[model samples]
Target: MKIASFNVNGVNGRLSVLLRWLESARPDVVCLQELKSPDERFPVREIEQAGYGAIWHGQKSWNGVAILARGKAPIETRRGLPGDPDDSHSRYLEAAVRGILVGCLYLPNGNPAPGPKFDYKLRWFGRLEAYAAELMKAEVPAALVGDFNVMPTDLDVYAPQRWRDDALFRPEVRGAYQRLLDHGWTDALRTLHPGERIYTFWKYFRNAFARDAGLRIDHFLLSPAIADRLVAAEVDREARGWEKASDHAPVWIEIADG
Candidate 1:
């Protein structure tokens, strides 16, 4: 099955681009981030018409996430991270589709670091780490897929030195990502294309996309039970160049039936 993840930026605003990609790519499952719309306004009709059944957790004009299963409804498994009850960001969602447990997330950007937002980002990462450990223990065929918002290594960045102090490339942030991977999850894309430059996002300014100045922020981390099934992983880089396109393109993987 082909599973994909895309940070749409805004589901409503990018509806056309998203629909166009969906029709062409035809992934079996998709995880979307940054819906930037409220639940009541999630544009369910348009998505359904495109042949996807979806479940979304939305917030007004900010973070949101959704899971879409082609021609089927994903059985809801979880919503929101478990560690914080007061946290209300719509950044995490999970579901069961075709015997795979998929967890979709939008990790915090935490820009302008050395501040509260950055602190929150670290805390959230810790929570994710703890929860991910539990998932490892469950020994289930699962994948944590989404815009993690952190580049795991210098290889994943266009210019590592330029982004050293940036939250996304900062040592602390990158360490957190490595810790998560240490929990026995396979970083699918990197595992397949070990030495290649693969990037999933680009800045709109400074001619980033045109220059191929990008970052590999979106990811598909597979649990050990299904890691061996991973057959292919790639970034749909062309989608990022489309008119009125999102800064992020889609990242996807294909897994052989176990």
Candidate 2:
């Protein structure tokens, strides 16, 4: 099975590019983040016409996530992250596809450090870690895929020192990310290219993409069982250059059936 993750920035604004990517890449399953639309505003029919079924949780003008699977209806396993029912951000979605469970997360972008936003980012990380523990107990084949907003190491960034003060590069944020890995999930991209500085997101400023200035925030964390089935991993860099493209390129991995 081939699975991929892409942060479209805004599904409506970049529908054409999204459609083109979907058509070209042809992944078996795709996890999308930052749809930037409310539930009612989601273009469900258009998406369906592209030969996929999706389960989405969206909020107006902000975060949202969805999973689209080819030739399969996404049976929603979870919509919002647990441990904080009051949290209203549409940042988490889980589904079962091809007998494997997958999760999509748009982790908070806690910029402007040493502030409430950063605090909330840490809090949400804690909640997600706690919630992941519960999922681990289920012992099901699974993968956690999305833009984590945390760079786990210097090797994962273009210039580790340059990003140290940024929220995504903060020590606390990195530690929280480590805690998630401690639960036994595997970072598929890292596993594939352990020593390479691979990145999935590039800032729009200063022609970041043109200069190859990017961050490896988007990820695919696999359970041990699923990790064993991994065949390869890659980032579709070509997608980033498409017209009206999102800042993020797509990351994909192939898995073998048990």
Candidate 3:
């Protein structure tokens, strides 16, 4: 099975780019983040026409998430992250596709540290930790895939010193990410390619991509059972260089059938 994640930045604006990748890569399942469109605005026709069925949770001009399954519809499992009814960001979505439980998430960026947004990010991380622990207990074959918005280690960022004060590389967020791995979730890409300076996101400004200044914020975390099936992992870096492409490239993994 092949599963991938891409943060399209804006599903509507980047429809062409997305469709192009979907046609080229043909992943078995895809978790998309940053739709930046409301539910009613999602372009279902285009997606379906591309030979995929999708379920999305969207909000106006902001965060959104979706799961796309090739040749079939994904069975919806959950919509929003639990433990915060008042939280309205469309950042998390879960579904069952081809026997694997997939969780797609757009974790908060938490910019301008020591502020309200930063606080919210930490709070959201806490909720995720709690829920992820429960998911681990369930012992299902699962993978949590998305743009986590945090660089878990110095190896994940191009210039670690430059990002230390930034919300994405701050120690607090990195520690939270470590706690998830410590709870038995496998960081698929890192596990497979340790010591490699792989990255999935690059800033448009300052010729980041050209300079190879990037960050590995997007991830695929596999449960124990699914981890055992992991065979390959890669980042479609060329997609990030496409015309009007998203800052993030598609990240994917291939697993052997059990």
Candidate 4:
């Protein structure tokens, strides 16, 4: 089965691009982030017409997440991350599809660091860590996929020195991500393409995409059970070059069917 993740930026605005990709790529499962729309406004009809059943957690003009299963409906598990009742951003969604538990998330972009936003980002990471531990304990075939918004290492970024002060490349942020991996999640892309510079996102400025100046922020973290089934992983870099495309390209993994 093929599982993929993409940050659409805005589901409705990018509906055409998304539909075209879905029809062409035909992933068995897909996790989408940054819907940037309210619940009532999600283009459910359009998505259904594309031959996928989806469940989405939408927010007004900001963060949102969704999961789509081809030819079937994903059984909804959770709409938001646990442990934060006051948190309102629609950044996390979980579902069960074809016997695998999939968690899709859009981690906060804590820009202009050393402030409240950065603090929130760290706190959110902590919450995610706790919940990830629980998932590990469950020992289910699962994958945590989406735009994590952090560069895991110098190898994952271009010009790491220039991004020293950026929140996405900060030491603390990367350390937090490492701690999560330490809990037994496999970084599928890195594991498959070791020592290679594989990137899923490129900034729109300074001809970043043209120059191939990119960052590997979107990820697929699989549990040991699912990791054992991993067959291939890759980034659809060509999608990023499409007309009116999102800054992020689609990242996907194929696993042996059970």
TM-score for each model: 0.99, 0.98, 0.99, 0.99
What would the TM-score be for candidate 1 when compared with the true structure?
0.99
lDDT of 4 by residue, 1-258 (tens): 999999998999988889989998999999999999999999989989889999999999999999999998899998899999999999899999999999999999998897899999999999999999999998999899999999999999999999999989999899999998999999999999999999999998999999999999999999999898999999998899999899999999999987
> Quick one: ranking by lDDT, best first?
3, 1, 4, 2
- Could you tell me the lDDT of residue 64 within candidate 2? 95
Q: Model 3, which residues run further than 4 Å from truth? A: none
Per-residue lDDT over 91-132 for candidate 1, one digit per residue giving the tens place of the 0 to 100 score: 999999999999999999998897999999999999999999
For 1-258, candidate 2 gives per-residue lDDT tens digits of 999999999999998988898999999999999999999989888888999988899989999999999977788999888888789899999999998999999999998998999998999999888887877888889999999998999987888889889999999999998987899888999998999999999989998999999999999999876789999999999999888999999999999988
The worst-scoring run of ten residues by lDDT in candidate 1 lies at 176-185
C-alpha positional error of residue 124 in candidate 2 after TM-score superposition, expressed in Å: 0.9
Cα-based lDDT for every prediction: 0.96, 0.92, 0.96, 0.94
- Candidate 2 positional error at 137, Å: 1.9
Indicate the residue-level lDDT of 116 in model 3: 97
